[model samples]
Target: MTQDLYRLIYLSRNTIPGSNENIHQEIEQILAVSRQRNAASQITGALMFNRECFAQVLEGAHDDIQATFERIQCDPRHADVVVLDFKPVEARRFSHWSMGYIGYDTLASKEFTQIQQATGFDAKQFSGERIYDLLHAHLYAAEKAGSGLGKIA
Candidate 1:
């Protein structure tokens, strides 16, 4: 029998205190580790990070997603971990990416600036679907432009 697919979206304050270069390195480490773990667990997802907050969408089996989120909540780098949405999904939105990443500069672009103005980067203000949509849109645009915006592997 086939396992069911589920999606989880969450936001958290970035508590990795440091200079920009240091923070970037930390995030790169996160992506590197996340890519390895998620791929091993058969999870695919996208992560968006500004210096102040992080929004991510994880898709996989229910148990795997739950386990991953639990680890995320306990992580020292994240503060105010909040799950915006979680439920069964018909399909994976990020099937190709083990862990796609969107950085601060990409988010500061004019196109995304309007989104930031409307929603703000505060983790408390976002809905899970909106976060998923934002990441999906970025991936779609990158694909269309033939750009490797967030592709890690």
Candidate 2:
């Protein structure tokens, strides 16, 4: 029998109370743990951070994504968590990664110029099919350049 696969995308402002250095460190810590846990849960996704806010996509079994998202919403590090999209999908978008990541600084990179020019590279404005398309394009460019963002696997 085929299992149901679900994908969830959310955007939230980073609300960690600390210095910039501390915030960066905190995010790194979150990534480390998230990678391990997501891998075990068979979840695949990418996280985009811009110091001010975050946008992440999670894909996996419906129950797994649902449980993971609930915990994410309760995490103090994230605030104003607005889910941009949630639905069953035919396949994983970031199949090779447990949790790939990209920082806002990449907005200035040549590879990201297309997305930047189109939407001003605004994280909050990203939603639904737009987020999926942008991420696929972004990851394709990153993989081709051997630089900015990559898979955890």
Candidate 3:
């Protein structure tokens, strides 16, 4: 109801049992609607996945953020939505973005194995903790790099 900034977040374990047959398509649809959602409200976020779980951070106005979460809650792709983190933010880290996208491209997908080897954690370790760490690090890294503020901030 208020115009304050909010970050909509949750973690969910996978439910489709390792089937890409529908995951990509489902993500595509989400992204499509996400653009429309972005038009209505400021939203920037990332989706992180290990072999089994998903963790995400979405920052935006309260109502639009909650509306998106409601849609994701009913999404058949993942289940057991737990609000791992949620709160208002004074300044959003992703203030420059509207609806950033990340999915199973070769590079983004390889983060799983690379994080395992680099962090010395197995794919399913730490409740997908390693993935979450790398997700924040790498996504922000990529955003910073692509933001074209190189050599001098």
Candidate 4:
């Protein structure tokens, strides 16, 4: 039988206090480590951060998703970690990416501004499906445009 597939979406406030360059470097480190670990675990996901908060969607086996999320909750760099959704999925939306990253630079200033205005970096203001849709749309646009802005795979 095929193993069950699941998707977990979450939001967290970023607690990585530093200058812009330092923050970027820290995020890079996170992506690097996440890419390796997620790939090893056969997990696929997308991560979006705007220095103030983080929104991510992880997909894999139920146990794997749980373990990964547990680690995320324990991570010191993230505060007020909240799981928006967790349920069985029919298929992966981010199959090509072990841990695709979408930073502030990946989106246009106007679009980013609109998002900031709407959510104000508040986790409570967004839903899991909203976060997933935003990430998926942006990733799709980036790929279509050949921007390579957030393609970590």
How would you encode candidate 2's per-residue C-alpha lDDT over 108-143 as one tens digit per residue? 223334443476856556555665666667766787
Clashing pairs in 4: none
Model 1 root mean square deviation, Cα atoms: 2.6
Q: Which consecutive 10 residues in model 1 have the weakest lDDT in total?
A: 107-116
* Clash pairs (backbone) in predicted model 1: none
Candidate 1 vs candidate 4: which has greater TM-score? 4
lDDT by residue (tens digit), candidate 3, 1-153: 555888765667667644585666666666567656664666776665554656677777788788878888998878877775567877676554454554555355477546545646433343333444555566667776774211111
Give candidate 1's error at residue 91 in angstroms: 0.2
Q: How many clashing pairs does model 4 include?
A: 0
The TM-score values for the models, in the order shown, are: 0.86, 0.82, 0.64, 0.87
lDDT of 4 at 67: 88
Alpha carbon lDDT of each predicted model:
0.81, 0.76, 0.61, 0.81
lDDT of 4 by residue, 45-77 (tens): 998887677888999999998888888899998
Candidates sorted on TM-score, descending: 4, 1, 2, 3
Which residue segments of model 1 deviate by more than 4 Å? 1-3, 108-125, 148-153
Global CA lDDT computed for model 2: 0.76
lDDT at 36 for candidate 1? 91
